[model samples]
Target: SSAVTKNTKIVLNLESLGSLPADEAGPLARYASTIQAQRHDYNGKVLSIRAEDLKSLAIIYDMSPDELTTRLIEWGVLSPGADVASYFDDE
Candidate 1:
């Protein structure tokens, strides 16, 4: 099935993951700290969300797959790369 390979991987920005703003992001949100800066300006974290699951999440949020993908990148949940974003998009 096409599901076996598409939208398989996405990198997350560790710094932004836990700091998603509450007012903007709702339940999974918290205040981000700016005082404790990363030693090497690091935000690297890799998390591969299963394609089906991501698709399901997008559906629940009433957002198109592309929109959700873009939002994830914006929120630092996904790496910022147009190529990466579209690589796994549903056909």
Candidate 2:
């Protein structure tokens, strides 16, 4: 039997996040600070977010994880198609 692998992480580009407006970048930077250990510098290409982090970050934006992912893409925090790890149930 074959098992499917579910992706539970999303990678972000710090430089891109830094370029955003203060109001937008503030929350991301604050969240990034808390996940120092999870952070990858040269980096999952940038900020590597786990499932838990994804949920938490969504809270900061008053969004659901799905919405946050879209917003992240819009903010350039996440690269359009390449950076995202498809969100799947953590179970």
Candidate 3:
């Protein structure tokens, strides 16, 4: 559940969300919503994934956390040297 909540917060904080074209924001928001719903289903249970697992999940989505951070930087979503994990430290 924390994973879900943490991920939701991270998504919400993405500066790119505001600047992204509707076509992009729509899907990203939908994905965040899905994660939110899944979190709700957990009823406060903790997710038991490690950072590496999170990285693997990111890969399934076509990026690693580092890659995502880089993309966010490229999109002006995050400061150039931001620590990506800080956005989801709960995980």
* Best model number under lDDT: 2
Q: Which pairs of residues collide in candidate 2?
A: 40-43
What residue runs in model 2 are displaced by over 4 Å at the alpha carbon? 1-5, 37-45, 82-91
Candidate 3 lDDT, tens digit per residue, 1-91? 4444334323233435556776645654455446657667333222222445446546655776767656656666445544556555555
- Residue 62's lDDT within candidate 1 is 79
Kindly list the per-residue Cα lDDT of model 2 for residues 5-59, writing each as its tens digit: 2443577787887678888779888777667654444444476667777777778
Shift in Å, residue 33, candidate 1 = 21
Weakest ten-residue segment in model 3 by summed lDDT: 41-50
Q: Sort the predicted structures by lDDT, highest score first.
A: 2, 1, 3
* Residue 11, candidate 1: alpha-carbon lDDT: 45
Best of the candidates, TM-score: 2
Residue-level lDDT of model 1, residues 1-91, one tens digit each, is: 6444344465445556667776655522221122124233234353343455556556756787678777877787776553344544446
Query: How far is 65's C-alpha from truth in model 2 (Å)?
Result: 0.7
TM-score of each: 0.54, 0.70, 0.40
How many backbone clashes does every candidate have? 0, 1, 0
Off by over 4 Å in 3: 1-15, 33-57, 85-91
Q: Which model is ahead, 1 or 3, in terms of lDDT? A: 1
TM-score of 2: 0.70
